[model samples]
Target: MAEALLTLAGVHTHIGQYHILQGVDLEVREGELTALLGRNGAGKTTTLRTIMGLWKASQGRLRFEGRDIAALATPEIARAGVAYVPESMAVFSDLTVRENLVLGARQGRLDSARLEWILGFLPALGKFWNHQAGNLSGGQKQMLAIARAIVEPRRLLLVDEPTKGLAPAIVQSLLAAFRELKATGTTILLVEQNVSFVKRLGDRVAVMDDGRIVHAGPMPDFAADRALQMRLLGLAMEAHT
Candidate 1:
């Protein structure tokens, strides 16, 4: 078994008088893709945000490489080799694709070889390298957003709903990108509603509900049990695909 790259024990998060995460516990294994699955309003996004320190955890421990990170600021977490790709596809609309990636490099310089590597799979970004990001289509914007996150090496990636609203082809492209990233040993905790996507790529699975992780185990077992899926996710795994 691989060591856990990140771990959250009894995590709790509050959002302006609303308690979103209540005693959440999860572990993302090193060099494996862990899927965060759930119905709407299950606090999956809150789990990712809290791990990134975008929202403070009211209580519990968040550990990265056995080091406490519950109190680290967002930038501090980024500097510690953690990156987040939000569900909103938060690309810099005003900037060119090249410029947006340039900003994602924390070292203040873009590495040409690295940029070429990212462009290899996400070739859509290569097409609009000089064009404004705002002019790109939804799928293209999503590619740019993920490309930015990997412009530099990151130890852990927290992604939320990455396949939302994308075409089947675009979703396959994302699956390919994530597979390649995993080949390079990038540990990822992905929150996704695309059941097919998760079944294809996830090594470990965790199901979230009402601000808590209700069920977690190997992806194959979770994917095989339709009864469990319907009970926890409120939809049959087959229906979701």
Candidate 2:
């Protein structure tokens, strides 16, 4: 197994007096995809927010590559080579696709070779290069959001619900892009509701409920255990797959 690139130990978070995370613990292995799974309101999003420093961890530790980053600012965390793609597909609606990509470049300049590489995986972005992002379809906007995150190489990607609100064909295309990303040794921590998507792409899986992880194991082991899935997620994985 690859060494862990990110680790959360007994992490807790409170949002405006509501305790959203209750002693959560997780490990994202280097160069591997780890899926964070759960039902609605399961602290899955909160975990991601905490990791990105969008939400402060009220207690516990968050470590990336052996450095403590629990209390760092969001920009500081980004400077440390972590990128986050929120579930809302947070694209600049008024900006052109080209403009959005340019802003996503960390160093105030785009690398031509990297831009070409990203375009190869996400040709939709290329096709709509000059179009306003708001004019694009939901799937296209989602692709643009992802494309922006990867406009430059980074150590880790934290993505939330990449397949949300997309047609099956679009979902398949997005999955293919993610497969290419995985092939490049991009470490990812994905939060997803699609059982089949997680099953297909996740190397390891962690299930969360009520702000804490309820199960952690290999993806296949979790997928194959129908009873366990039902117990944790209140449904069978096979039904979704």
Clashes within 3 Å, all models in order: 0, 0
lDDT per residue for candidate 1 within 90-141, as digits (tens), equals: 9999999999999999789999999889999999999899999999999899
User: For model 2, how does the per-residue alpha-carbon lDDT over 100-180 read when each residue is reduced to its tens digit?
Assistant: 999899789989998888888788999999999999999999999999999999899999999998999999988999999
Cα lDDT listed for each candidate? 0.93, 0.94
Score candidate 1 by TM-score against the native: 0.98
- TM-scores for all candidates: the values are 0.98, 0.98
- Worst-scoring 10-residue span by lDDT in model 1: 232-241
lDDT of 1: 0.93
The whole-model C-alpha lDDT of candidate 2 against the native structure comes to 0.94
